[model samples]
Structure formats: structure tokens, C-alpha cells
Target chain A: MMTIKEIRKRLDGGDISCRELTEAFLDAAKRDNPALNAYIRITEEEALRAADAADARRAKGEALSPLDGVPFILKDNINTKGITTTCASKMLANYVPIFDAFIWEKLRDSGAIMLGKGNMDEFAMGSTGETSYFGATSNPHNLDHVAGGSSSGPAAAVAGGLAVFGIGSDTGGSVRIPASFCGLVGLKPTYGAISRRGVIAYGSSLDQIGPIAVCAEDAALVFDAMCEKDPGDMTSVGSEPVTPKLTGSVAGKKIGMAREFFEVMSPPVREAIERAVKLFEKMGATIVPLEFPMLRYTLSTYYIIACAEAASNLGRFDGLRYGYRAESAADLDDFICRTRTEGFGKEVRRRILLGTYVLSAGYYDAYYNKAQLLRRAIKNEFSEMFKKCDLLLGPTVATTALQKGSGLTPVEMYQTDICTSSVNLAGLPAMSVPCGFDEKGLPIGLQLVGPHFGESEILSAALAFERETAGEFLKSSGMGVKL
Target chain B: MISLDELKKLANLAKLSLEGEDVDALAADITSILEFANTVSEAVVDLPKDEAAGAYNLREDVVAPSYPAEEILLNAAEKLDTYFVARKIGGTGA
Candidate 1:
């Protein structure tokens, strides 16, 4: 599980070949994916060929970028040209896009080898990996427990050493929750920091492609490779020229703590994040306790807005052009009806129906419009809070990884994302770095939230935290994280 | 509580179908979620007059090489020559 930086150094020093590294990771994926269900498809032929091409380029002293020869996994939701991008749903079970996502094109230019597409919650809609049509991704640390979703397999693959890092989408807590459960570093960069052109839309306004790696420094390396604007995505704001000063010193840095996030938090989880906050304080940082009244309603605001957008964005999948088509229908209406009803899973259908109800006449203002205004107020509150502090700290999730069959209702599962979703609502950057292990030996994560486009600042602070802790709890808890 | 009839209407709007007790179950689910979402109506806020941040980042109306028409039609279940084949919207040829 060498860092991408370490691997690059080795590649430069002639200690390893890109083809050899790709083969090794391919071997790991073969060994682990069957047990963990991490990868939906492993592109062995293309990846090894690309690896050889990379090696040849390096032999000619023409390395493309610093990330050249690095191997990583992509969440299945991202289009990879010829490879199938299923989004782990039956509807898209056969989808193979003709083009690559903006980030995929960027990573390709960097000469980063793709191992495979990681399994995820269907349509990136659920909290646990069980929602995947391919099957649930198991936590590498505990076989019986579930990996968090919708970026479940990406997190598990990184934590299981199947790839050097994983690229995943975080719409809501999809990326962070899995990273928290798997004890990996996952970043949800500021909205529009990375272009989202070829990503299969879930909640378009909230979705952003990001990196999940072993640590914040590794995540930072991948983040740099992905921060480019594309003409394809008009919303993508070109990454600001803010050189991340990784001072590793947080002296006098103001870290805000919103108590409402901890109100319903389990004791072990609360203790774990508070422990991280204390470590920051010990490093000469100042803790600024605060309250966000608007945040209490964010979970509701998220579902309303996210669902409304999903209902509209998903209308494109009616079996006319591509994706799953019903066997036979009397008319186009019946065709659309059968295609959607048969192709979608229970959760997807439920969301579509709820979204339809909210956006319907007479209910639009009461639900969708109100949610939008409340989202603005929440964003404004976060902006005002940033004026008082450099970063905000809290638990990544309210609890540790639940067992695979927790049987929680949809709202109950939605509650698990309460601490993480508000960041998405405000379009701010946030990272979930493993802080400590809960009593059950499950890992807990500390979520560090930053202002809009403050990726470098948050990464710098996260690096400081990772350096200070250095997985001290792993030794105490007897849980071996693949790193 | 949302009735099953309303659930059917929502499903119709979404272009999906819900039948039998599933509709009843969905009604309960949507109702409970709406109960939670409805609280946002109570939130106080002054709406902004001008919501747009600034000018749109409009790209030039340039015609680049698109996805080859053949490639685009490759996945269609039914196609008539270069066009995708579908049933007529309002008629079933009945």
C-alpha cells in the first residue's frame, strides 16, 4: 500500500516498472474483489497496455505528470469511454459511454492507470453498499459489516490495497461516510472545483468528483491532478491559484465547533471527533465553539432539493435512446412505464415519486422552493461562520459502520448523513480523515469543513492532524488498516 | 397521510408504476418524509432580489466532432436507419 508519491519515487529510481506495479494491483484486486465485491469490472487488458505505454514514456524520459504510472480505482458512476459505467443499477447495467468524464481525461493525461470501476449504491442514492445491484461491498476490516455508500467500493478498494487510491463521487456523504468507515482519507472538493461533464448525474448541483486515498497528503497529490476546468462543464470554476502551504503548524488557527452536530451523536463517535479537535488545540490551535440554528433543518433541505433535481435529471433514462428497454409495450407511455418500473430498484422509485410530489403544482413552494431558500440561508450561515474561524470540525458520521442488515428505515439511514450533508448543501470543501477507532474496533472519522474553494487550507490542516495521530488507535484497537 | 390514489398519481408523474400494497407503503414513506421536509416552510429567510452571481461562462457556439451517429445508435434497442425507433407518443397503432 505504498503512497502514489512513494510509488512515483520508486518508478523514477528504477526500482519498479509501471507494468509490474499494475500487475501487482491487478493481482490484489483479483484476490480481494471476490470477497469484498469492491470492483464491478476490472479492465486488465487496457490497464496493463496503458501501464506499458507509461513505462515506455518513462524509459524515453518523457513522463507525462507526477502521477504517471499510478494505479487507481474509479467509482462505477463515472463514464470511462468503452468500459461500462453502471452506477450499480439495473437500468444502467449495460451502459458504456462513448466518452470519458472530465476528470478521467485529466487523469489519463497524467498517465494514471485505471484498475477498475468500484461498485457503489445504485444511482449513488443509498448510505450502505447493499443498494448496489451487483451486491454489497464488505468492509475489509470486518467481513460481516457493510462498507458505507454510495462510494462504498472505492473506499473499500483503497482500504483493502486493491489500488493506490480511488476516485469517487460525493453527493451528500457518499464519499466521506465510506472513507470514515474504512479509515481512509476522502475529500469532497468545493462544488465545481473539478469538472463533472461525463459523470452520470445523481444530484447534479451537489455532485463533485474527488479523491479517496490513504492519507490527506496522498489525497492532496490526486486532488492537484484533478483541479482543472473544462469547457464541457460551464459550472466548473477553474481551481484558484492558491498554493497550499502545508506548514503542519496550526498555531493560533481558529477551528469552529458547531454543537448541534453532536446533539444526536453516539458517545464513542463524539469522543473520537472531540479527540481530534483536542489534538488540533494541542498543536496550538484555538477552538471556537459555535451554534448553527439553520443546520438542524439541513437533512430535510438536502432530501428535498436533491430529490427534486434527481427526478428531473433522471428523466433522460426512459429507454428511448439507451440503457435498459422493456421487452414490449403497446405505446411509448407504456414503454416508459415498464422500463422505469422494471429497471429501477425500490429506493430509486421511492425517491422519484417523492420528488414528483414535491415539484407538483401547489406543493412546489411548500417543498422545493422553501428548501432552496433554506439552503441559501444555510450557505450564508456557513459563510458567516467562516469569517469567525479557519475551519469547522465534527464527526464524519453520527455512528460507526452498522452491520450489513441494520434494517433502518430510509429516514433513519438519511439521519446518518446529517453531519456530512450540510457541507454539500453550502457547496463547501470538506475532508474526512480517520481520527480514531470506536469501541467495536470500527474506525471513526473527523470531518474538516472549509469555506468555498478552501481545499488547500483543509488539506493542510488534515495533513497536520494525520501527522500528529499517525494511526495511534490502530495499534491500541488491534485493527490493521491496509495502510 | 398521503392516500394510495395520490401515490399512484405521483408514480404516474414520475413515469413509473406502483401497484397494490406497494402504493400504500409508498404513501406512508412519502408522508413521513414530507412531514420532516415540511418544517423548512417554518424557516425564516429574506429572499435575495438578484440570485445570479454574475455573467454565465458561455462557451462559443462551436461545432466539434460529436459522438459518431453510429456509436450513438449502437445501444438503441430498436432503430430505423439512423433514427431511434419508438412507439408514437399518443397512439399505439391500435
Candidate 2:
């Protein structure tokens, strides 16, 4: 129950050994993982070895960084050399990468321990984690409810006290929604802010690896370790250099609450975010008002554009290489067709079909190009709104944690991502922090979104809010984990 | 609404096979999805190209040692030594 700051302080002060800290998390994971199903593979041996190395470094006064001994979870989609990166899909059920993801390499160099890869929706496809081949991750708040995904297990693992922090790729609400559901802090950095070199692609344009932690400060620390310009990634951009100068004060800052974000949220979610707005005002943050009609275009724009990109990105999985292959095939064509047909789940196939249709010659102008234009408009809409305010505030998800077997149809399911997807569409920095819990005792997350490359402003606002409210929430709810 | 033939065609293009109940389900799903996608048409306009396309990085063209051939092929489904055994095209190399 220690924050990364306290843990590092203790480790530095020789009060706790890295091996001892890792073993404590390992024991807790072992006790809780059976029912929660938080991790796909518990790399105990590797984690212990890394912890011992960290201990040795500390012993020699040669620790690599402040996060040297921290244990963190990765969404299964990110590659780890010699570790199977299944992406929680049958398609890549046995696929192990020969190289580490850029983020993983960065963290590894920092001496952070890898707890294991956390389960996700297949190919990061679903709003709920139920689409995972390994199985749905249970929300830490309630056993029968879902850990909102596609970063379900990562969120669950962090919330369930299984890891110090987690790394998840947010395409359309993957990291943020789960963080909301689990009552954690999840940051989806500006697109290209974090390198995507070895992440299994879902939407090449929208996918960015971000941090999920118990609070904003920890998220910022983990993000600092991982955010770097990778020559390997063409889209990777240089660091914005925010950490050293994080003035966690939002006094006199203009915090905008979009009318569109409030219009459709459930009552409890609205109340929590409204309460958060009042708190921001109390903290001397100015409240600005704005309405956006273009916000309505996001769900469709994100689906079309993401699917289109996914269609092309996933074309490499044609059964000739690593991953699940059909046993029965008469020819090369049949082999590919059957391999994909059998390997992919229903939702993944549905997306592939939709993506193909959008990019098809006949429908290209109508679907793909139109979505791009709408994407531009949405970006422009935000650009204009930022002129009136410093950051945007809203609900991360329309509702709290969904029931595990809600059996909501796909269209119904898509609505779960309504509040968060537009941020991904515009490639902006957004954070979801625990605001309060609802009537069912499930957590409610308050979202703070900043303008492009404005992570500092948003994180500062979020940090101020957390510092004000953390003690009360921690005392009452005990951090949203059932155990 | 997408027809069964259209679904099949899309599946073929995606290198996937649709059989049993998937065809009907996908058709219905695509229909609803297309209905949602239709919303974009209203906002579509021929706008000029963006003035600031953001800073893009161009790496120098340099030859670097890559993952070894054996290591790279470690996950290939059908492989013989370092060579991947792929489907024969053009009948014995013409």
C-alpha cells in the first residue's frame, strides 16, 4: 500500500530490500491472481533476478534510477524478448518477440522489475476486457463486474495491489477506461510522445503507450522513465521536458468543462465530475464553458480511422510467420484464410471486415476520407476550444464498472468509450484520476484533458486535485481493490 | 445494408473465411456500423491541406546490424534452417 515515492525512499534508506519488495508483490499476486486473473504470465524468476540486481546496485550505491526496484505490469500487446506477447488473442497465442518494446527497454535500463504481461482485449479491440482469449479480467471493485479494458488486467493488477504500476497502450480508451473502472490514475500521453516500436498494433495512428498507477505523481514518474525519442519509430517525437518544472499549482488556470462531455453521462458520473469542477474552482482554477457539436463525430471517426489503420497494420499476420496457424489447409490461400478465420475471435474479425470495407476502393472516399476530414474538424474544434481554456475536464467513461456479463451488443459496447475516444482522435494528453465512488461502491474517474503537448498543465491540475482529495478517498475506499 | 456476398468479398480481401453464423451476424453488424459511419458524410468537406503537419523526423539512411537471421526466423511457422518454406509460386520458379 506504499506509493512509489515512499517505496523508493524506504529502499534508498535501507529499510526495505528490492528483493523483499518484489517477493511481497509476488506473494500478493499469487494469493489474488487465481480469482482476479490479473497477469498472463508471472515472470517470477526474471522478476526476482531483476530485484536482486537492483539490491546489488543499491548495495554498491550504483542504483540506476529512482524507480530501480519498482515492479510494473505490461499490457500483453507490448513485446518482451523471449516472453510470449500474446496480445490476449488466439492469433498470436504462442508468438514471442525477439526484441523488447522501446518502453520496456527504457524501463529495463532503469532497473524496474517486470511482474508479467497483463491480459487485454484481443489485439486491444474491445471496450470491456471480455474479448481476451485468456479470459475476462474481473473488476477489483466487484468480483462479478468487468475490469473495463482493453487494459483490463493491467488496471486490475495495479488496483488489486499486484504491481507498483502498469503500462498500457490507449488507442481509444484502452488505458483510461480501465483506470476509471479500477479507481487508478491513467495517463494517455500525446500521440508520438511515447515510442510505439514494439507494441502490437491495433490502430497505428491512435495507439500510444501510457502510464497507469495509483496516483498522478507515480504515473508521471513511470512516464518519464519510458518517454523518449526512439530512432526506431518514425512517429516518435522528442520529450517535451515537463518533469523538472512540474509546478503542481492550478491557481488562476482556466479549466474548461465541455458541454458535450456532460450532456450524456450517467447521473453518478456527472455528479462526481461536477463535484470535481467545484473542487477545482475552490482550488482557484477558473471554470470555462464551451459547447462542441463536432464531438458527436468522434465515435464514428475513431472507429472508421482506427479500423482502417488496423486493417493495414494487421495484414502481416497471414499465417506464414509466428502465431496460430490452421492445421488443415489445402493451399497457401486456404492456409491463410483458415488460419485467420480460426485464430481471430468474433470481435477482431468484425473489425477487420469493417476496416477492409472502409478502405475498399468503392467506399474509400465515403468512409475513410470522410473520417479523416472529421478527424481534422475534431482537432480544429479542440484547438479553438483551448483558446478559451487551459485544460478540459469531464468523465472518463459514461458509467462506472460494467457487470462482467452485461451481454451488451457491440454498438452498445462502443458507447462505453464515448467520453474518452475523442482525445485519442485528436492525439491529445488526458488523465483519469479517481474522483469518488458511485452508489454501487464502484469507483468514478474524473478526466482532465489538455491541449496538444500540454501534459504539464493537465498533470499539474490532476496532481493538485489528488493531493487535496487523496487522504479522504484512501481512508474511505482503501484504494478500490476488493482484497 | 451489406449483402452476404459483400461480406464474403470483404472477408476474402482480409484473408479471412466467413462460415456458419458469422456471415449473417457480420452483415447485420456492418449494416448498423455503416449507418453510424454515414454520419461523417454530413461533415465532410474538401479542406485545404493542413499548414502545420507537425514536426516529422527523418532518420539518416544507414546500414545497421539487424536481428540475426536465425533469431528473426525463430517464430516462422514453416521453416527449413534459415529459409522460410513458403508456398511455391509460378511452378518451380518458371
Best-performing candidate as measured by lDDT? 2
Query: Could you give the DockQ of candidate 1?
Result: 0.64
TM-score of chain B of 2: 0.77
Candidate 2 residue lDDT tens string, A1-483: 457887799899998899888888888788888778879889999999999999999999999986899888999999999999999989898998999999999999999999889989999999889999999998877879898899998999888888889999999999999999988889999998999999999998899999898877888888889878898888898465566657778899998878988888999989998888899999999999998888888998999998898888888887776888887666778777888888888888888888999999999988887788788788888999999999999999989999988988788898898889999988999989889888998999988899877888888998899887754443222332221
**DockQ of predictions, in order shown:** 0.64, 0.51
Off by over 4 Å in 1: A241-244, A473-483, B53-56, B62-65, B90-94
Per-residue accuracy of model 1 over B1-94 as CA lDDT, tens digit each: 9976777778889999664336666778888888887878778889783354323368889877877789999778889889998877776641
- Residue A253 displacement in candidate 1 (angstroms): 0.7
TM-score of chain B of each: 0.78, 0.77
**Model 2 TM-score?**
0.96
- What is the TM-score (0 to 1) of chain A in model 1? 0.97
Q: Which candidate is the best by DockQ?
A: 1
